[model samples]
Target: MMNNATVFTEFSLSGLKDITTKNRVILFSLTLLCYSVILLVNVALIMTIILDEKLHKPMYIFLCNLCINSLYGTAAFYPKFLFDILSDTHVISYIGCLLQVFIIYSYASCDFSVLTVMAYDRYVAICRPLEYHSVMTRHRVAFLVGFSRLVPLLCQAIVVTMTSKLTLCGSQIEKLYCDNWSILKLSCNSTTANNIVGFIVIFFYLGHNLFTMCSYVQLVKCALQSREGRKKFLQTCVPHLLCLLNATVALLFDLMYARYGSASVTQSVKNFMAVQFLMIPPILNPVVYGLKLTQVRYSLLNLCRCNKQVKGLN
Candidate 1:
């Protein structure tokens, strides 16, 4: 008899079961629409920031990095998801599964890290206006941005590395995409080390959230001191808070789905729970920034106007 627990070459994803061709077509169209919006807005914001010299400040720099990461994260999931929708098999190669886990998790981790850095940037600008330029120099901003991207990636690298060593007895993932927790569930070996490290990474980033929220609280308190501070907070700090809340809720949903979601729950809810992090934040962040942030909004408008003028000249 063949070994049932032998190393599997591929894993089947099981979320799209029992769907008809019509429904699959509808799902593909909607996913493509959403992914297109994600690309358009994120790329628009990223290009706006890159092209506009005046938007090169620390805050916008961080925001540009956020959009860039959104693109990176969504690219990992959406392309494969669309392909799976068109095919009979919802399976991923072992290496591809690990790579997806790394990109998706690291993307989530990178969001928090970027937000934490943005909070610090807001703190300096609002709490210490006089020292803003001196403190948030280009060099400092580059280092902070580098810090935000590097830490989560390295941390996720460790997690993915740990996950790759597991002796998986089964290969069917209960969710739509490959994730570390789901992969961990397949492992016949003990996951104590993986759990410890995963917890450490979770708490470490949760600390980032705590620091960011406390910073927001202090910012609000400072904003209440005067009218001008209040305006600045409304303009800048509020959007960051909204984004934080969005990210927190999405992350929490995924965490719950990964741990507590059951077959008893409807698949629609399960799909939403698994992918809220991927779906909502990428769209919301750029929209919020583009609409709310004066510089970005004006820059986008100017970009559009310039494109029109060039077209007219042609």
Candidate 2:
């Protein structure tokens, strides 16, 4: 085993080794298409929310941030992933690997945080209708949005810093992208401090999930008591729930794969498990909110019509 003093400069990603040259081209095309669509849809939704004065409410503002985050998260992975698919070797430089870890994990944390805030927005709208506007004021919403982005970036920064300080015995990362736990697994020294900090971050985010659940539970209780409440819940809260469920399931798959994944698993299955979170949630969130929210849908339609009219006038 390499000792603490051993210097490693790069990591070879073994995840894409199974692809044949012919298959690599095909996969690269498909991946590029997927990434393009993720960008197109997310950008469209974000622009729709930003340009429409009618969508400047607290709920839409939260959604705009969520969409912005989807773009942020995907930018970290998709470009590099597409390049890896086309290249003969799948290796990432040390700094590149650490940057990926920081962006990906921070993106995950931010997803949960944004969803938690969305749940709170829904709860206020439905449970405390009279104070929804007051409670989720423009200033308060700005603070919460800023908080959602800042906290995750800060937490993941510490994780990346801690992981970077470790002396690694090996440089093979089993997955297509760099992950914090995977790097931690290569450490030549004690990782107790890292593990403790990791667990604390996990439990903190888990608490965010629990808070979301409690909010929904109360939302369900309140929704059932009134017809209008039920309508509001179905209109707004359902999409939030779907986004939450998608993010939760995607993260769970990633967690399980990182922890107990076996070589015996088929490469395709392993790849799917490894990237499910990165691939699904970023694409799914915007689609879900775009289709489910009436205001957003209408706004999008109006934007389309206005664009066509401009084309005709020109």
Candidate 3:
């Protein structure tokens, strides 16, 4: 007799495994509200950047990219997630799982990449003020944006492609959303290539963060000597650091939890760990940048004031 290996065409998400109907309804409402806020704030910030001609600099440009990418990343998780919150079955087709893995993972990798570019922009603005305009010209800004997006996307495409080739034996993913590590764990085949590439991607992730940290160190050294430098550092660099820390910490939590979290951990904790990166950063980044960056803050306020005045006049 020949033994046939079990194959799975779909996966069950056990993150919502034990919730009652009342809890599910409450969770769905809360999730919808969160997603709504995320869309509203990010969209507002993006429009504030686009409409105000004065805000059309490298810094604002990159910040806009950050907000847009936040939406991109969250879209991967939120719609499907909201549906799953109400759903009793909590199932996803294999292809759907792969799509989620690609979008969410690429979003994370790209966030780091954009932050690194933004860090370089700040360094040049503060440290090499004389050449700031020359260095971060329109062409260069465009190139940096493309580089930040393309490299991460390309890397994630490779990872997700590798994942799609695997023959999964188990059909249950323990976490809230589709994750590469969870899928990899399900594979009966050797994950040597996936691990190697995943580590390389992680190394590059760390590389982006390390580069940003070093740049900020140099920035702090430069800012101490001058009042204007200190102002710029406070106004701009501080928010960037907040965003960096927020996204990095959130992503690290998810990554660590996905690969090494104890199965005995409570499902609620697992859900939080799984979704923090997706939930927090998308909403947080735009709000932080909007409040902390003066130009954007003023523009947003004016935009709101103008809208109210128009309403009154109408």
Candidate closer to the true structure by lDDT (higher is better), 1 or 3: 1
Tens digits of per-residue lDDT for model 2 on 240-264? 9999999998997887778778869
Error of 1 at 20 (Å): 1.0
Worst 10 residues of 3 by lDDT: 1-10
- CA lDDT of every candidate: 0.93, 0.91, 0.92
176-275: candidate 3 lDDT, tens digit per residue = 8899999998887889999999999999899999999999999999999899999999999999999999989999998887887897888898899899
Model 2: worst 10 consecutive residues (lDDT sum):
1-10
lDDT score for residue 249 of model 1: 89
TM-scores, all candidates, are: 0.98, 0.97, 0.97
In angstroms, how far off is 136's CA in candidate 1?
0.8
Write down the TM-score for model 1.
0.98
Better of 1 and 2 by lDDT: 1
